[model samples]
Target: MPTGKLEWGRILGRLSPYTIQKGFRYLKHFGFKEFWIRLHERFEPEEIPYGPWYEEYRPDPEELEKQRKRKWKNPPKISIAVPAYQTPEKFLRQMMDSVLEQTYENWELCIVNASPKDASMEYILREYSRKDERIRWKKLEENKGIAENTNEALAMTTGDYVGLLDHDDLLAPNALYEVASALEREPDTEVIYTDEDKVRGEELEHFQPHLKPDFSPDLLRSNNYICHFFVVKKSILEKTGGFRRDYDGAQDYDFIFRCTEKAEKICHIPEILYHWRTHESSTADNPESKLYAFEAGKRAIEDNLKRSGLTGTVTQTKDYGFYRVKYPVIGTPLVSIIIPNKDAREDLEKCITSILGRSIYSNYEILIVENNSTSQEIFDYYRQLSENPKIRLLRWKKEFNYSAINNYAASKAKGEYLLFLNNDTEVITSDWIEEMLGFCQREDTGVVGAKLYYGNNTIQHAGTVIGIGGIAGHMFVDMPRERSGYMHKASIIQDLSAVTAACMMMKRQVFEAVQGFEETLSVAFNDVDLCLRVRELGYLVVYDPYVELYHYESKSRGAEDNKEKIRRFQTEIEFMRCRWEKLLKEGDPYYNKNLSLAKWNYSLRPKD
Candidate 1:
């Protein structure tokens, strides 16, 4: 066994023994609040006078040297901004001491005071400022609220980047050093955020890993996963004009979205670097705060909608974050649903019926391309369906080429949008049209697809995991419903690098812009190729589980047995190598590198 795997095995070996027993005990004792807090403070340097309690323990000299060597670089100047309201005096002093003791020397501290009644806060700030020139203090006559106070502190930040720290939150000793190193590595990054743990009183309770590294707008749109203590470029912050006072309760989320829009790049530091205090009064402790958050979030979404020039109305749904959008019918954006088939006329009929019956939006035409069907029944079925005004039948006459057939259909399409629907899939949602159309209608979105599942209720296609088993393929093949795992188990809507062509929708303009699919590669991996090209053109591809469908793989066509499956798989591998060389070089935009996928292990074929 290799050393790395061997070491991992050994650790895991020991873990399994205590994990069950100790895990339950730990959960009962500390809870998520304490666990989250302790994980972050675990690595924080303890030399600071005050701050979260770091148990008295010194790291081995060799390990300390390794840690120091990892951060060898020109550190960017980082300013820690602490907006103090009515926080305890001890907590304020502790926060100051934590900053002063950071291993990364190039940092300044800005304390914006919003407490007029407490002279102790001012006294502590004055004493800290007097002790360290890097510490700066500003006092308000009255409480300006946390959001406003944060804005006030924003003006005092002169460093390359600004780090948000609540008066009560504590930073690990290497927090600044880790961020500085990450920024140094990704110089173009405008925002650098880290995973954080929550603290309750003083015990470690839970760990929330923010391991997602890719910069995805859709991910942010869905939830504020990149929140908690984050370092953002000062220039970008200044440009966005700090937090919007209008979004008082959710100002941080608003500011983050606007800042992300202006930022060209972002980096996620995988380590837990900040300790978030989780008291009963804190937002983490209260669910009622969701109302304000929702309103602010809605405002942010409205702004994005207007900016994108999409005509839609948002309405609240019973589900907390769930919403319904009614898109007004402007001039009909003609849509063509392209389907490829060989045999299985019954399956095709069902597929077509679902679209015609369930679609809330009208103004779409279906194009069924017959791929050399050797069945007389299939020929008669098309003849019977020719009377349907919205359905068009095209005969491929030659061999079955999934890519070529779609490209041929697209060339004949009169619609402004192209939808690829597989004959084997049955649409289950009434809002499928609106769900996909909303994304396809957006100028920034290129391709949109629906979630697919087997007849057994297990997932069939949520998204594709590139570089899986020396071949990039679909993930969550047949997993039972459980915790929302990586393949969008919990999310109804998400941004994916590629969706199954089994049921995909795209704007005709984007399809034409990328010249549709590469006809050389037939059925497999063509969706990934199309999506990659679309993304390269600066458009996002989204996968929405809201429009659910049952996909009986290759049911419309005769299923190739083992020998043909291998042959087709080999062909797909070669095609993927030729078309997706860039993705292989920089890595798939969606696949998490730390994950155990088969595709990440190989060097893609050399680009021509």
Candidate 2:
């Protein structure tokens, strides 16, 4: 939301030798067409300053005064717990001062000091306690550990809600006010968390603001996205039993999982209310400093999986802090790979060959639906493929109606799980089917999508986003597979609003529950509609980057070049807009509002 001229000089300065290196690599590997497209997508949007944007939307003095004076009908008191160690005088003062400056007055700060050696902190806390009665302090003779220290602070709180605050970090003036507002909006909410950013130095120069999506369970398992500005109900905290010493390095991550699982209604406030201060010794400044914390995070995810009545081996991904869970395929359930094909015998052959030859998971049947293929060679290939017991050939006499053809094939499928695939796609990962099946087998997962690339090394579809290109578009389109998306989103597995049906998997019961894809959306948006409807039925659509495939996009059906095809595409777009009017207007919950919908990349929205 920056409102000013583009600083071209500063923007060009960011194009370092690394940028040039990537450009040359792209040109050498992907050719000029792809190189130009990738370059445009990366640099077309101006890189705006988040500091100015924050300052522009930040609440003024008069607004804060109004919040301070507002009377509430039984406002729930929020108790903040701070566990302190060897805290510097400046940081300790700032942390306490940030709480004291809160607009909401019905709050208390419970400080459990383990910094016995730092005598200066004792004097600071005593002075603050004298100045404000809400500031309560307790000095522990010995540092019991972070988990126990937080528990000691939690024991001191008497409010209805409890919040955790790191001693060196800071809370924005509106942090407590937002929590109170969310409680009024959703009274049954047992857990509430806000987005946060990293700040440094005396002025607290803001950067790396995390504009998070709605509460996503699958995404949380991938990484601890909800690490800051967190608050929970007093009852929920009591039920979770605070934190455990075993997960001391990553106790907050473990505690968050426990709280969310116990809460009936969890709310997310999309505001940067916490500033995680980074200094020399802080893990935020250097990830390599505490490798043990990452291992503990992996354990926390494993424990959550066990609690959910599932088992998986959680392993670290290429990204340092991020992790991946390889859930074992339970009981070898049959998977139906349904492909709707026309002519393109070569394309269909490649698709089936990859599944039969490269696939590591057996016990899958391929149902190939032939939709009016005129070529004699395709029929010849089909006749040869019919000999295999694992492959079944079905006929569709009607014109290319994508939804109806798939629905008919799905009705005939005998498997418990259904996989919708495009004939133009060839499997790249050996265990691609198993990779997707692992996540799809989860009770909460309704749809699972694989990471797809174009014929070249560039990406075709990582996931789908609503209201991107009028209705919906794929994320990370044309980006090289070697590079990651914004904030390494391309490299991580997370929950999304929608995924391309060209390579999607879901339960057979779920497909029937939604009555299959909407027949009205014959070609375009049919997959997105099905995914959205599945989500409405309280299910998550996960995009796993580990499942890889090469998508020769539209090779069988060809492009929408003719007049009739273009008209049909336009009609589908209008249909999606009318059907999903609310989502388009309100924005996608899986995507952040601050990000630009103008492009597939998660770039900053230009505030003109």
In terms of lDDT, model 1 sits at: 0.71
| Candidate 1 local lDDT, 1-608, one digit each (tens) | 00011233444464544344544554554567654333233322222212222232223355545656664556788988888998887677767887876777788998889987787887888898999999998988888776788989988988999999888877876788778878877888898777665665545443323345466666666656667668899999889888877887778877887887778888876556777766545665443435676677667766755655666666543323434444454566888999988888888988888888888778889999988887898889999889999999988887888888999999999888888989988988877876788777776789887777888877787676666655466656664322134323334456778887899999888899999887766767788888888888999888776678889888655565689777986887887877667777665656554344542211112212
On residues 76-161, what C-alpha lDDT tens digit does candidate 2 reach at each position? 99999999998999999999999999999999999999988878999999999999999999999999999999999999999999
| Pairs with steric clashes in candidate 2 | none
Model 1: residue 344 alpha-carbon error in angstroms: 0.7
| Separate clash counts for every candidate | 16, 0
| RMSD after Cα superposition, model 1 | 8.4
The parts of candidate 2 lying over 4 Å away from their true place are: 1-46
Worst 10 residues of 2 by lDDT: 37-46
List RMSD in Å for every model shown: 8.4, 5.1
Cα deviation at 389, candidate 2, in Å, is 2.0
